[model samples]
Target: MPRAALPPVLGCDFSSSPSRRKPVVVAWGQLDAEAGTVALQGFHSFASLAQWQEFLQQQPAWVGGFDLPFALPRELVSQLGWPSDWQACMQHYASMARSEIRTLFKAFCDARPAGGKFAHRATDGPAGSSPSMKWVNPPVAWMLHAGLPRLQDVGADFPGLLRRESARVALEAYPGMLARELIGRRSYKSDDRQRQTPERAQARAELLDALQQGQHRLGLRLLADTAQLQTMAADASGDHLDAAICMLQAGWALAQHAAGHPLYGLPPGIDPLEGWIVTAPLSRP
Candidate 1:
């Protein structure tokens, strides 16, 4: 079967803190007909962890491209001396509050130098992601600390987690990795009413064009109509939409796993579930 006919379940735009900020919105699309090609299927915006949890409970299984880092490096895990096992380690980490995680990571970074404090993967910079464990700036470190625990609590069927005996929910993804390759340092989103400049709009438009053309190695194309791309670009806050596009890119990479990519893509000695991104089952536990 062709990639497009595989059923539409991937592509997610996430809010790192859905409980406080706007909900995570997922836009799903696929090639609809034999000749018509990719079409927008449906979109879902998750309001709360509970709402996402509910979705997971009902859906059982489908791939999603979420905006969160999928896994922390094994080197960092060992340095922290957290549980070596994935599940136990994540459970332990999840029990702590966000402030606690910040303190822990902050203390570690303080010991190192400003130049070498934060550990990084070879892929981090290309992906335009904050250090998976950094608490400051983008605060992705806290995000993993915040997001992973919830995934554990929900106990979705993560073959990746089960395989590694780690409950961390490991997923290897960074939409920016692909996005920047197409448009470098091009600002495409803003929450500030004053900063929504024409440059940003042009950036968004260019990105949409690139995606439709399959400019990235996605191999598959985004079969959106011109109107759809314009609508998505028009949203002043295209961050979520950009994230959704990234998610879709990641989803394509994931489907490739069936053919050759690593099923979990966890680094050497890392547990599978520790950082995987997944769709919430449609029903709640």
Candidate 2:
């Protein structure tokens, strides 16, 4: 059978709050195969779940690389004695607020101070992400807690939760997963203008340069213009960079699709709800 056409591209800069005070930033693009066109479709800051839901309802066919942990480790779930099933597990997680989770993790950590505050997966190092269920630091744990439940509630097709087909695949992605591959532990973003020194500027420029030069395993070139780079640079929140990195991952996924890899070469058995990085597929000898 012939392969399906590549899915439309969606990238998100997630915010757990997602209220008017802290809206979720969504960036979407469409890749036109024949023309090799990757055009920005829209950017939205959704203040309510309904708004986000409405947005998803309109774009049901796009495969999105969202900057949120798609799942908590099964190890954490077994430790907490929560149900192993994805929907039930997320329901339990969605029941708790950020403060509640913070308190729970704090107590858990306090009880085992000698061991350390919280457990982490190996990907956390390269991805520069906090544990997917933790409340502090990068707070990605809370992002999964907040975001996955919504995805579950809406019956969104999370690659970790639902099976992958042709129309949509919601995968967990950290742009840092790609960025760290290029510049490990290098700081490329800062909210403080004074801290945005020449070094950091060069790092960002180099990162963009690498993408333009097709220097990564993805082997995809960024066709973004200088104006787009300036706009992405002006984003102090780091979401724009995250979105751009996700765009790179999306491009890589398209390439993988062309190579006839199932599920875009995503590893088998990643938490169906929690996602994984867009690294090079492990090679067969």
Candidate 3:
């Protein structure tokens, strides 16, 4: 039996508090499943969550891989006595104030042993992502708090979280998973101008090269013009590169779907309360 064709994909680098200084960046592109190629069409940056939500609402019929946690740890959710169902949990989560969330998470961590304070989602280990409950030092929990609701509001489909929407599918993405596979902890881009040195720039170049040459096991090559490459390389914040990596992940997910792994390679029986990360090795079905 043959699988369906792939659709357009989006890769988003989100911010909990987007502004002109650090806007949410979205990379739009298409994947050639047969050719195993992904092309970067362009980028869009939104300085406000409202604007981001508006764009998502306007753009229909595309699969998106967003660089944000889609759910919190089951352990954390259970301890908090929140709803166990994903949609219900998200609804409960979205209704809370940020201060309330912070206080609860803080107390949760404060009571635990120092080294084992943060509860982790199953995806966190494979994705090398920070615990979604952490309020600082990456604040992925805040990202989830800010980002997931927008997807829900727009009626986007997220496997195990929301009912499948035929037009708009959303998947959780982490660029670090793919980046680490290529460079093995080599720093690529830094938000701090002082930290964005020649070495990091070179690392970015090397990563781009690896993708172009199809060095990864996914065997997907990235296609971008010289100008686009320069723009991605010159961004000191690395948001552009992260978005591109996420786009590739979206493409991979599409390919996985086309190959008959309908859940985009996410394992069956995964905790519905803790959604899986796309392409994470531990997430293989």
- Tens-place lDDT digits, model 2, residues 1-285: 975676677777788777775577776776654454455555667997678767876765776777787767666677778888877777788887778777777777777768566766545555556677677667777778767666655555654366634465666667776777677678888756778776776777778778666677666666666777776666655667678777667756655656776666576665543446555333310
lDDT-based ranking:
3, 2, 1
By summed lDDT, the worst window of 10 consecutive residues in model 2 runs over 276-285
Off by over 4 Å in 1: 1-7, 19-21, 31-38, 153-170, 258-285
- Compared with the true structure, model 3 gives a TM-score of 0.96
lDDT of 3 by residue, 1-285 (tens): 866666788999999999999999999999998899999999999999999999989987788899999998999999999999998998899999999999999999999998999999998887788898988988888899999999888888897566665678899999988989999899998888889899999999999899888799778899999988998888978899999999999899888887888698677778889988988876422
Query: Better model by lDDT, 1 or 3?
Result: 3
Q: What is the TM-score of candidate 2?
A: 0.82
TM-score against native, each model: 0.78, 0.82, 0.96
Worst 10 residues of 1 by lDDT: 276-285
Residue 55 lDDT (model 3): 94
Q: What are the runs in model 2 whose C-alpha is more than 4 Å off?
A: 1-4, 18-23, 32-42, 47-49, 125-128, 164-166, 192-194, 269-275, 280-285
- Residue pairs clashing, model 2: 70-273, 70-274, 71-274, 132-141, 133-141, 160-272, 160-273, 161-272, 161-273
Best first by TM-score, ranked = 3, 2, 1
Candidate scoring better on TM-score of 1 and 3: 3
